[model samples]
Target: MILIRARVEAVLEPGRRTEVRVPVLLIASDRRWLELLPSQRARLKGRFGTPRSADLLAAVVVVRGPPSVLGPPSPLQRAAETVRARLRRSVDRLPADQRGVLPGMVVGDTSRIDPDLAEVFRTAGLTHLLVVSGANLAIVIGAVLGLCRFAGLGRRRAPPVAVLAVLAFVVVARPEPSVLRATVMGLIGLLALFTGRRRQGLPALAAAVLLLVLIDPTLARSYGFALSVLATGGLLVLAPPWRERLRRRLPGPLADALAVAAAAQVAVAPVLVMLSGEVGVVSVAANLLAAPAVAPATLLGALGAVTALVSLTLARLVVWPAGLAVAWVVWIARTAARLPYATIPWKGGGLGAVALLAAAVVAVLILRSRRLRLVAVAAMAGVLIAVVGLRLLAPGWPPPGWALVACDVGQGDALALAAGPGRAVVVDTGPDPRLVEGCLERLAIRDVPLLVLTHPHADHVDGVAGVRSHRAVHAVLTTPRGPGREARFTSGLVVRQALTGQRWSVGDLTLSVLGPLSAGPRLAPGDDGTTVNDASVVLVARRPGFSALLAGDVEADAQRALAGSVPAVQVIKVPHHGSRSQDPAFLAAAHASVALISVGRDNDYGHPAPSTVDRLRSLGSRVHRTDQEGDVAVVRTTGGLSVVPRR
Candidate 1:
């Protein structure tokens, strides 16, 4: 699919006749539309729809067959697109991750970035590196100013060169609100530098903000714009004082780096929390660790893009060092993201912002006192040591002797039945990739002997990339019916039809597919997919004294069909997330010691229906809902089976 920004030249209606310049998102399947450039007009045949709350566009246009070119793009846009294409080609031979990252770091072209790596970048809080920001422009302007100095140009003459560099960088990055904000901030810095007055920085910043906001009032609502302004303000208003304090005890370079990272993180923390609903505990460290390579990568990438215009060979030569730099940055992001507790969940929205600001105030006030500062440091150090000690010596996650784990993936099913150390049978990889990936990582699951996708529903298979990102899956099994486009990520994998009476063994565990006695029926793609839910692959896993029936989202009809085959077990994954359409006799036949229900909190669909919970309870089974607990695990104990809830 191609997403294009276009204006409404005319609205198609019974008698309407007008032209409007409103922004719209055009979704089209024709590959030819991908060639369209910014500022070019297009005659689109589509149905106009209202934009969703989260969409940035004013309207959504679903285009038919193809687009008709209305006009050619301006010369500047054409040149920029050509330069971007060349920059992309410059890193054609680099490592896969580096090739994707270099262009993104240089010109904000992220089309080539792997989805898994993009998620890793988000988790590591290194997402900023992929986008064009004040940092990128600052590096470019700094390099240009240094070059001017080396060329014997005085400071007075350097500002003009820096201005040219900023404008050029803006064009390459696309003149979006965020890029424009960065450009203005870069010019403000150059203004301060050319005038030889450090104090003018704040006034220049204020003037720049005032002018930019006046020019585009919508920027005030842009998150990227806010982050860019906050980061630049942090560098100017907070970094100098913090650096002076750090220099007293550390080397100049280390102090400067630490100060800049901490200041930016501090300034953006509240907004970041509001945006992501999580606070990056490791972002400052990750940024500082990756900072050294960013400049070389940015500068080299820019050089490569420029040189590509002359010779592709020269561009490749310049980008070779850039690959190494990008590799280092990617490594840092992956390593940092792999750390447990890399980010801590925080509230989102207005309350979260106020809470963060209040906490910052308290921290600052305490740091102002020498005695209080020492006490605070000691307290933080003690807490950190205690948490680390617990994680290493007695990590509560993935409890030992675990037979099965139901990952809390918010209204979806992602379960792991242990096969051996760092190996398991993963089933129904939840709705969100990151959520499921985090669950697998916490379990230290490195190998999957078998992956069972119950059905093609998005909640069950949208997270395929996360599961396969850094692990080895020997094989995959799914229902007889093919999955839809939502499960396209797994299309490359060879998937076998999971038939009734099929069996597989890995390590000490045995798995048997036990349901959908027939090939089942097919429904239109636009249907509610309840028939597909009934066609879910049902399996029962057994290991030593532990056994559990892994029921997919089968409703009552499928449950009744499998009633004769259902066997009594210690645990049962409540079908359809315990929707009201459950078969009581089928549930009662399980005779389980534990009933694990996976569902989301405050979900639109009232899952884990109270009736289902009561029915399971009436059967003398212990019920555990993932919405209440973070991850629910069933562990074998000497006495009997015990449930461990990770909250």
Candidate 2:
């Protein structure tokens, strides 16, 4: 059995549907982990949004009920929490996305950060901007000193003041492991500067690393630590030279961004691949896009955090510029993350890291060669020309003749059934409209003849706008709207109930509703809280050479009923995100050639449960889960069936 002992951090914090993703802190004996979830989180009850300024001693544990606090948090801790809380409330009236990003830009109160928003940052390689780290600290403290210098403060006076500012900001940020690491690194650089050892950048970095490792040996094994130290070292040793070279041709602002992005990317790309198994194609470009917003957002957010203690209204007034800055960053992340080939999958682990490091070093060396630089520039320009030419002319995506595409929309379902050129039948928009919109855009789908919602779960139907955004949605099909779920994709388009035996055609593909039989089993009167997932509308699709059993969220009881009406198929969208609510006999009956499960990565609830995947595999179906493989597609050719993954 897998066991997780977590400490409650905050409660009823903003959620995605109503707002943003709330966070709870998991306090293990060894370390703390932030738990981001929709499951288990809802089970806790209380007036639980504790002000960040309070002594945060209370907790609701899932494994063991409320553990005793060893003692109250220290006064400094209380003060920091208060500032963070005030900062949070000051921006509470803003759009949830903007609000979620504000505290994060300042002190990293990411409890309000939506998982969908976080995922966008991850894909765009902008995770650092959202997380509390050295970069944020450096920007805030540096700006403070720069302001003082501009006001004619002497150099000696500015350094000491900046040092104090760093310490104070670190406390306000709560000195989590990553924050602590950043503080230590910043101090080392500052110490070097003060001692007139600025040329010893590498030595300063080495000393910081040695001292940190001695203090917390576990950090030696930390991916964050490796990334942090390497990134700082890159900035100190590599960025300045690149800046000088690029300044020869590029504007100062462009040159600085290019140098900073390249240095960090080269230094951390290997570790990033080691941890995430992919290198973002848009990392440099995304960083450039978001660069203009970071400093303003950070400074204004910090100002708002401090001012909220005095006047909430003033704090609100102060944060609007910060919120706008955050909005720009969010927009950059979303747009860059969805670009075709956002990341490049690479070999993971130590060997891959070492190989990539060597390659990065070689590229740096080539950049130093004047003659080779011209050739490299020409080669890069040629690649860009080819890419843009193809994008404008032949467009290489949605790979011709593809039959089915299962979008990687986190813990939800969004799929497309090809109809004709630029047309498809879309099913089940995921939780975030933006995510599903990108999926459709990637497929080049411009018209949706029929859009089917499996059920009324927020994860299933919430992304209606994505379906309606780019296309003329002729009609919509779904079960009778669940409580409070009457809103749909198009007011003009009809939402027909998906009763059993309902049949339709989109291009050559035939769709038949196979489940939610009329007059079927629902709950007894007193069991009103039971979910209606078992009542989800199941569909079966078939064409000349391809067939699929698309079971929505039906559980064992209804799975048995649906099995009786099933058609033999080559693929199946496993029901209920492959929860263990499956009936083995039902899976055996369908015997689909491929079983597809759509789920979010690192979800709280163990989805596409291991046993469920084993059950499908045991029944002779090759299993594919979206959480692991990403945007799975089934293509049928003359030979047999094949599976293609986005990344």
Candidate 3:
């Protein structure tokens, strides 16, 4: 592979950047990628996509070598990198929670953070700390000002000291685009404090916006930059009344903390909802829990960074309390993230943002009402109780006697056969690993004793990563390898060739594999895939009374070949995503009451061909397309078999 070095830049498109990933340009190199970081250079080799979705490049290799820096960075950038490196080293001696979280709390470095723990922050809504918001800057500067006052420094002396502290913080936190954005907001807040006119901060906010945009015209287009400004405005305009109202009952310090967190969350809720397409239900409480630790962590962390310039030993000492504080914050994120109803999925886009904004307004209005406040409080208590009660009493998942679930994996097939609590027999993985993983998470499936891939097609087996991400599998079952058609997936899984008459029983339920009319279990090599569809692994699952036939993506000939044994199943996974090339006779022989077509929405192939659906329906089979419905599950109720869709 040829390698070329280039500067890295964000994806040149709006609304595509996310906290978890970024699409970027490797300038000077010919690749356009989605996982590249901003403000850096890299050497990588990748292939550009062809036809539809062209221009997108997927990297196969990212070459690692010393970067060719033409010149040294500014003093501020140098100072920031130096302090950040020292801070990381000092905290490295701490436990994972502290080591991973302290630098993030202080300088917005999360490269060494754990993935599960990162997800915990997102679920609990503590992501802002890791992003380096004005909160970090304020904490550091406030601590300096407090010390100045304690030393009996005159008011005139304090402003300069605070200003110097802010400048120093900006340096030690890096002058990257994100840090620069946050620094501007921090300076605006300082202006308010220095002038003793909190209201003037509004004007300062506007000025900062104009000034930053003039210097970095691209700031006008950055969602992260916009969010930082919005959060700062929230602190100035909304936090005071919140503090006043909360102080009526809560202690002064605690009320202030809650006020600041609530203000920022409420202010940015619309934008965040639009970007993430979901609301973190536990965000308020999670932030409140982490609030007490933020100031101490930031202040002490900054102290530790400064101390490192003198002695590493003293730096470690200063970081101890900060590490403990961060540990507390990390604990809050992890515990609360795992709580029930921590995040509620929402439809994303302009409409979703508007809806969330309306709800936030209603909440504020209700809280403002004296008499209605009591009613609202009681109503909220009842709602919380009801939600917990329902989750405990009647869990929404693994509904009683749910036989199977056909995950909506977009143009591929993945069927989950229930075995026991948190366990399932997965049949076929979709085209993408992430999508399949999401389906498993929704099903709350954590164990897969068997993962059966019907054939070697990408759509049928590529999603192995999804399964690997979610749970461990006992064995991966597939057909014997063919020379040309057996799609290869690179994984460490032990492969078992599944052919005719292989059966497994679990708790009175029996799962049997019975097809691939090959002479033996060994696949014939030099076999081109003209008849590969006919060679799909067919599954028959029954639980004493009910049975379903899961036919992989077999076309007409394979369908006809397998039809003889497929008895009249109550549910059938229609072949080839309900393509046009299906056997009418085979459809009739299956005698399925409910036929499921796992196809993508608005797919280019026009899957579930009109003839296919018509043919199935003509055979008296109720047809359901995953494109129209979401995850379609087959349930055996007292009223007989019914198909349920969950979005």
The backbone clash count of each candidate, in order, is: 1, 5, 0
Note the Cα lDDT for every prediction shown: 0.85, 0.76, 0.73
Q: Among these predicted structures, which one has the highest lDDT?
A: 1
The Cα RMSD of model 2 versus the native structure comes to 9.2
Ten consecutive residues with minimal summed lDDT in candidate 1? Answer: 521-530
Ranking by TM-score: 1, 2, 3
Pairs clashing within candidate 2: 15-20, 52-81, 52-82, 53-81, 53-82
Selected candidate, larger TM-score, 1 vs 3: 1
Candidate that beats the other on TM-score, 1 or 2, i.e. the better one: 1
Output the TM-score of candidate 2: 0.64
Per-candidate TM-score against the hidden true structure: 0.69, 0.64, 0.62
1-647: candidate 2 lDDT, tens digit per residue: 01243344343446632333333333221112222211223233222322221122232232222333334556676777778888889999999999998888788778788766887899998998877888788787688778888989876667677788889998787656667777776777766566666546667668778888898665776677788888888888889999998999999999999999888877789888875668788988999889988989998899888899999999999999899999999999999988977987776668878878787787878878999888989998999899788768852455557889999898889989888889989889987787898889888899998898877666788888877885788888886423224254446777677777878998798999887877765533222211467767789988878888888788888887777677678899999888878987778777798999998765545576779988888888998877757788787778878887876
Provide the RMSD of all predictions against the true structure, rounded to 1 decimal.
7.3, 9.2, 9.5
Instruction: List runs of model 1 lying over 4 Å from the truth.
Output: 1-19, 25-36, 40-56, 60-74, 115-124, 148-161, 188-199, 338-341, 370-378, 396-647
Q: Of the candidates numbered 1 and 2, which has the greater lDDT value?
A: 1
Whole-structure CA lDDT of model 1 = 0.85
Tens-place lDDT per residue, model 1, 66-153, is: 7788899999999999899999999999999999999999999998997568867988889999998877887898899889999999
Model 1's C-alpha root-mean-square deviation from the true structure amounts to: 7.3
